[model samples]
Target: METVRAAERALMARLPEGTLMQRAAAGLAAACADFLGRVYGSRVVLLVGSGDNGGDALYAGARLRRRGAGVTAVLLSPDRAHEGGLAALRRAGGAVIGPERALGAIERADLVVDGVVGIGGKGGLRPDAARLASAAERARAAIVAVDLPSGVDADTGEVSGAAVRADLTVTFGAYKPGLLIDPGREYAGTVRLVGIGLELPPDPVLQALQHEDVARLLPRPGAESDKYRRGVLGVAAGSARYPGAAVLAVSGALRGGAGAVRYVGPAGDAVIARFPETLVSDQGPDHAGRVQAWVVGPGAGDDAATVAKVLGADVPVLLDADGLRLADRDLVRGRTAPTLMTPHAGEAAALLGVRREEVEAARLTSVRELAATYRATVLLKGSTTLVADPGGGPVRVNSTGTGWLATAGSGDVLSGLAGSLLASHLSALDAGSVAAYLHGLAGRLASRGAPIAALDITEHLPDAWRDVVRD
Candidate 1:
């Protein structure tokens, strides 16, 4: 990030040369020691690059050598190696090996430290560095990355080519946006933060929801609260071909904060059969009577008319699946009430007219771009669900959810849950984020280790909500 680099430059100027590097090396060595268990007689290999990243690994290698471990530094660029670091490693009994010897040393190593690139590096690993990365993967050695992982874009979380898969990353000062997002987040494995006392700005590039944060935002009905006062949610979903979508959506809404659920769709029989509490109607969303908020799309198939009718309402609207495809862009941008869009990578790519891979590679950028273009709250669902407000403040990344959540009808459940929260009068931003956190939690609880249906996720919503609100 430009701001982060500027701050780093300012801080480095004030501090003595090599002081920050020394602090970083100390923390790195301590982490390596813990991983090694017994430092004495342990074989450690360092993949050294050309910058301060390589210097940090060399210095940490020297520390390990002093404690009786056999340390070997594999120089990717012998001509560009850090002179001082090389001298210190030699003095501390560390050996410098060539790229030809890196594979053999790595195979026998107890631990391997990746100092091939720092946060400022772009694209992916180079040819020589990529060779070592491949060897590291094939070896039994536990890989530890210095700063951010090699080849990951620190600011954007994009990975285009070959990159190191770190078993554990020791990041100094602060977390890069890449570490928290997908693609890069997957390559990063597990992360350990080693603070070196650099003062960062108060507002971070991303924010994650905690249980306490979720508890504070949940709506609770007062003693005098009636169904109207508590909140009413209108759901326009499902059809003859996908009546289950309407059933699942209403299932989610009933367990949500909304006091009443109004179903206006062709799946009225299915909805009333499953949930007799719902007020079913044959008319469209325009004739569904008054509702605090409306959920559109999700298995409505090609029913653009129902999507259009719901979009015309004055109430807060949440658009998902088919609704995201069928809505007029200009009308969405011109709405008076708050609007929320939930799209997976494919739908998002369609909206932006880009490839799905492009959207997945640059999730943070895509989410923000969508929010700015639509001028509304956008929830980008994937490995990490991110909610971006129109203003581009810190995006909320949902920490919950499992890979098992990538099932059918999941988006439908999310739509109903978020729309209910909107009906409860939360700002679009809070409603989307809070619902995402709970929905993910429910998925995790439902699946645990096995596969779960979309309806199962909706069934667990009450448990998830109580888990958040419980003292």
Candidate 2:
């Protein structure tokens, strides 16, 4: 946000005075009106602080006052209020009150515009501002943030102290990194972008994949398509103890656009029983026929040998769960073929030699660092699944997942699906991201607002895939 704001200021200077402010105020006022359905007689409260953010609120409040809404400004810093904006509000018949009176207005407000801090503010809300935020929450009023929700680190999406939880966030020019990521994204509610004509760089540090992006990347069969021609995804998962892991991973692979699935593990019987179509081989990966890619892990028990053998293969490999734990770091780093590592927060933390909380708090940095460390593509799975290549380019963020998708064995399904895509000849980064998108969509469809089993997710992969392609 600092860099963006610097660019904004430079652009503002090049334009006429108050031009940027007017543009921001105009967009903000329109958003406020749209949110507050019948503007006439609506109770609007503005949490005005001491900066350009406050100016935007005061100006928007002035517009609301003219439209027959009773507008009240809660001034946190009366002396530091925007002079023109303050005067404009006064002329438009809006009342100004200090913090003591602010709580009363907030309690009765139909809508609250949070202008307490803009993107530049750090940490969280102060004592007085925090009180207003709390009161507004208790009031259950629809709150629209002027720029960003106060207290969130615009760059890192980290929230340190008390921050405003808004119903809608109206941002100017472009989308900030914080609004698209979690922790901050959860607080932001529904984001509505308000353009004010500030030119930004062509590339962003992070990206979220939409339906079109996924649609274009999905693999398709051709005239020469067959089991081997389409792709053969090898499954080196499961054990005598957890043979169901092999069944689940194989189930995912069958529907993941792969024409064939080869099973090479201790649970060959289990794989054959559940998926009779699988080509079973207990002789391990070397003799598992020709597989384009390998999905190692899930429930391989403590079998480090299988993980090692699969990693040693010249084919692309995806390491998940137990495979992630058993694989040797030096061997993995030395691999010439494409490598993809899918780790939850705990696994990523262990690999980075840090606490899980550290990894969770700064997911962008952790994922990027892990990719560089392994010289491979890294998919950090969480509420927001992220995929990054070894090169420090824009990371792809999956926006399709729900909390219901966190069920047991879900990661196993993801591993098989992604591995299938890898076999079908997509790059490591594309395969991981596409798998996440489809996995999340399937989870949503299977759950339908209820708790879902891992098996349910595998069943819904076809539906998710059809929805993407059909769209």
Candidate 3:
């Protein structure tokens, strides 16, 4: 996983006057050069602010000017600009203009570089700044943000105020959380990281998934495997009120490479009807025979009796949906077997005793905190799904899936697949993230254009697995 850090201690160790800024500018200019087809006569606009962020943009503008591109800097605050960078830009034939002149130049520019704020700014764009950002957003020109979209909080992926929506964002040194999450992520568009001579340690925050990591972690069947020997997943989900969740969960389990799926809930009849291969047992968890893992929650509702029965199982358990609601953090902490949690933003907030917005803002942090607090592996679902282990390791973000996955019961399928993988002996963290990766891909495949049913998402799991396992 690639992570963005608050500060790179190694970079701080050697304070060479302008090395960082120079590297940042060179990277920015190179990236921008791709967007500017013919710089000799093309117009480029730079949205300048007060800090080192503006210095980076100004210096890049100087480089662009040398390449014969017509560069114009829109100084948000002329009194507080980076003096050295401004001088360099001026010497290289780059023109600086206030907000009034900026509006005209921005309208006609081919490219816009937002250097308004770096990682240090707070609470979005100010009133005047917001106007400029808003205006730039409406422009037809391609927009690129320096470091990040001006108003986004780098540490937490939160947008507290108005922010510039960019076509691309070139980050320095490492990726900040903002570039990988929603709200802020939406504004950031596509992110490209530029290593600026900063050797960062392992990030406390995590984002994005790489193929090699996923391939190493995903479970594969070995020789001498049988139905029971492989592992059986006991699903205790759904209620009479909502039996579709049971069918969906069963669908996911059936395709999850499990030995067999034992349905042990009120909705067993529904599951058996949909998937005749599933062992139908009207009995509770205690009487449902043996299984390697239990998947609880989904549409179980507020029934305490059903939840208790599922909780009594001896196998490793994956809890989601209603299971998250009835979950006692203390009980989860006491479990001997591994426990994995799959919660969306709202459910996570409920589990962590915080607001939904808070969980969404610091998704990586929230998932890790929940893992530690409950002593379980946690999967926080959203655009960038985060998976973290209580013991501590890199938290992985699932880069797959689209907004269309917000359909109903999609999470139920995720829980069942994750539980099945866990039953097959993968570690809780690996199981959760691998299942998520497959689930997200399944959703995208199932919903090529329109929204797909939750059961449809489950049906596509095998196809997704093939895509991942294949070259």
Candidate 4:
């Protein structure tokens, strides 16, 4: 938010006063008009506060008033409201009501514009503002938030106390990190970005890779490439108790860019039965034939020795499930080769020695902290999977995952998919991000609204890949 504020300030200094505000108001009004379909005779209510956001709502209300809609501004702080905007609304024949009448106006409105708080305001809404937010929520009107949904942390997606649950969020200039991540993302129903032409920094704090971004990162083998030349992924997963984990992991690895998948575990027979293409070995990862990268810790039960051996390997490794629990912290941090740790909120909570609730509440902080502590790329898996590099540049946020993906053996598939990408020479960050993207898309494709198992996700990986690469 400091970066966005600084950029806003820099842009404001060059332009005339209120130029940015007008631009925002114009876009907001246009979006509202489009949403309403017929602007004439519609009842529009503005929940105006004391910030620039309030002015934006007021100006937009004035625009709607001119279009023959009955506009009403319910000012939370009447005296502190933007003077110019208030005057414009009055000139356009829009009614100005006190907070006392806010609820009734909101209920009667066809559209409710929430400008009670802006990006600058933090924590939660004040008591009076909170009541209005509640009224807007319960109202039969469509709620549209200005700039950002009030009470959501623009920098981190933490929602403390009362926040606006908007049907549509009209954000100006740029997309805030909160809008892209969870908690805040859930609050913001459908985001509509209105470009105000503010020059932002080259390196963003957060990034959400689209299909084109994933397509560019995906590795393609040449005509001359052999199986070994493409990349061989070593799978050190499963045990006598959970041989299915090995089969599922291999399912994902084969679909991933890896040329060959070498299986080294107690599940060798099971692996061979499911995937005859896999090079099965009864030996440990250390004894297993040379491979480009390794995926360890999915259903290995208590195999600490196998986890240690995979960590000692020179190539990149993806640690997940039981492996995340058994692997030594010192060994993981000391490893010279790239290491990617994929942990669900519960596993991450254990590693950080905090409550799982805390990790879920503050995912951004948890992921960054885990990455720094382990000196490895951390992919914190959840409703929104976040991939953060140890050094920290841009934390990639993945929102493509469905609730259907929260099934058994799903993490195993993710581990294998990510490990294969690492073997194909993608950096730890790229591997995690690309794997998450495809894995999420696969979940969506397989489920299609019904329930789906982990195998369904692996089965649809090719469709996800094709969806990304297709023109």
Candidate 5:
């Protein structure tokens, strides 16, 4: 929020008064017109508030009115409304109404512009505003939010109370973090950025990797690359209780661009049965042949010894599932080698000593806190997977996942995939982010709108990889 505010303030200083608002209003009007296929005879309702956001909507409503649409501005605070915007609406033949008549107008309109709150507004909407938001949600009209869906934290993506759920959010300047992360993301149906020429810093608070970004980070084996030269990932996972975990982990590692996967644990037989090519060893990770990186603790039921051994290996280690529980925080913090910790909201809550709901509610804060506490790159897996580096740079957010990924053994595959990337010499941050992108894409491809098993995701890894590096 502060970063956006600072940028807005800097931009507004050089621009003439009302110039920014007009630009934003123009973009909003254009988007609304595009959304309403035939705007000439459509009814548009503006849920105008007291902030500049309200001004943008009012001005947009005026533009719609001039285009032969019946526009009505329902002001929550008539006296506090944007003076210039209100005058423009009045001059353009747009009608004005108070909150008392907002419900009827919203129901009668073909589109509802939610400018009742903006990014600056915190917590939730006021009583009257909430009522209008509720009415807008119940109405048949398509809802459009200006800048951001009201009542969502633009910086954290947290929603405290009643918020506007828009069919489309026409945001100006830049994309807010809330637009990408969920509950807030769920509220913002589809986001459209309207560039108004505000200069932003190169390093943003959050980073979402697209195909080009992931392709650049993906490791490709060179002509001279041997198995060891390409990368070798070590897996110390599973137990007598859950041997499939080891097999799944190795499955993902094999497809994760690693030339070789070395397995060491009680599940060696199962690992070898599934993937005969894997170098299987009954000896612990300590005696396992040299490898570039290690993935520990997927269904590792009570294997604190193995987790500790992998931690001491002096190579990049991906800690997940049971590993996240058994690994020592002091040891994790003391390690000089890069460490990537993958934990779902439940596991993260255990690490942070908080409720799962709290961690889920504030995923950004929780991921950062976990990274700081463990002194490692932390990936908080959920609807929006986040990778936060211990040193506090921009956190990478991946939204490519489907709800079907909640199946068991999914984290195991992710751990192995990320560890393989680590072995390939990507930093913990890059490895985790790239692994998440690929994993999510694989999930989507494998599922294809249906339920899929964990192994299904591994099976589609090649397809996902090809899609990324493809032209």
Candidate 6:
């Protein structure tokens, strides 16, 4: 779904006068009638605002009236309702009334349509409107929003104040950002888009990658593939303090279809102890001997020397955790091969010199900025993990991650899986997103109900792969 703000220019250029409004009203009426089973004899209350949004509600009410439904428009703004729509509603047997009259009628209705605000409006419900909507919330009928649940910012997806708690939100054209993000997302309920004759842009501002997309990107083993032919992933992770991180990373790499995983660091012995299959050596990235890709900084701490050695390598690198902290953007810019950065919100904020809240507010924009700034493919991890390539196109938000995947050391597993895929010769964006989807699916399988350890996530990779390949 693309943000509403991003489509304003195109909408203004193409939408004829009242054309989008009519399309919106028709879609809204259809959805409401479908939900009510039979709109004839059903009572619907329209909470009319002062803009085109109210116009949409009033127009929809006219349609319902023609079908023998009882419709009432509760005008929040006394003299500000859409004039043409208000007259049409009255001509079609719908009554316009004050809040007190509207409240009593709303209590007896089967459904309430909230037209309090629309895409252009910012902040939350006004005090009078908030109280009225709150009362409707306690009523017997379901609350359906006209454009979006009013009071949620269409641009940033943040709630300024109290928003109508809707059972369903019928949006026009593309989706607004507020419909997809956290606090605002909770109040939106199930969102349905109603196309209003707008052409979808070539590259959406934000996109959710589906299962088929991820399945197409998986590595297929060929007949000539050998251990080295498949690819070797060099891991420069772990220290005396956090040896388990290295173990988890190696575990993910081994299970991520990498032909071999070379572990290099002070915690090499610890890594080998957990997984004897991993080739452990104290040698850094340079001496790791012809690795296809390097996975750096999972648990290496703040050691400058080890981080420098890893960064200096000529191979494709997946930088995570401490590697992100130690990065010099200029050096990353000079890398000849592809580079990928995987960071959680906080780490991403630090790398981009912004607050964590800033990264969360405009996640799609922030991820793209991070990708462009570092000239690398950036994987911003969270509930909606986004992968943005530096050159720019649609940003992919992984909709597969489970909340159970929020546990510690889970990111290390992601980095290892992504690094392994990169080593297997996939493009940076494809490798990162594919690893995320598999890791997220594994997290769900590992933690059917209770909490799951990071190591448990490693064992489910094959299951995820099988499901994708089979489908």
Report every candidate's CA lDDT.
0.91, 0.91, 0.84, 0.93, 0.93, 0.85
Question: How many residue-pair clashes does candidate 5 contain?
Answer: 0
Output the worst ten-in-a-row residue range by lDDT, candidate 4.
180-189
TM-score for each predicted model, relative to the true structure: 0.95, 0.95, 0.91, 0.98, 0.98, 0.84
**TM-score of predicted model 3?**
0.91
Better of 3 and 4 by lDDT: 4
112-139 per-residue lDDT for model 5 (tens digits):
9999888888898899999999988988
Candidate 4 is scored at a TM of: 0.98
**Every candidate's CA RMSD:** 1.8, 1.8, 2.7, 1.2, 1.2, 3.6
Candidate 6 colliding pairs, count: 0
For residue 140, model 5's alpha carbon misses the true position, in angstroms, by 1.3
Model 1 bad stretches (over 4 Å):
13-16
Q: Show the colliding residue pairs in model 6.
A: none
Q: List, residue by residue over 1-471, the lDDT tens digit for candidate 1.
A: 766676677789899998888889999999999988999999999999999899999999999999999999999999999888889899999999999888889999989999999898899999989999999999999999998889999887789889999999999888888888988899888888887768788888888879999999999999999999989999999989999889988888887898999999899999999899999998887788899999989888999988888888898999998889999999999888999999999999999999999999999999999999999899999997999998889998888899999998898889899999999999898999999999999999999899999999999999999999884
Question: Candidate 2: lDDT over CA atoms?
Answer: 0.91
**Regions more than 4 Å wrong, model 6:** 1-23, 30-44, 61-72, 83-95, 100-111, 133-142, 160-162, 182-184, 448-450
* Tens digit per residue, CA lDDT, model 2, 1-471: 656887788998899998898889999999999998999999999999999999999998999999999999999999999999999999999999999988888888999999999888889899999999989989968999988898777876778889999999999988877787777888888889998988877677788888899999999999988888999999999999898889889989988988899999998998898889999998988898999999999898899988999999999999999998898999999999999999999999999999998888788788999999999899999977889999889888888978998988899899999999999999999999999999999999999899999999999999999999899
RMSD of model 4, in Å? 1.2
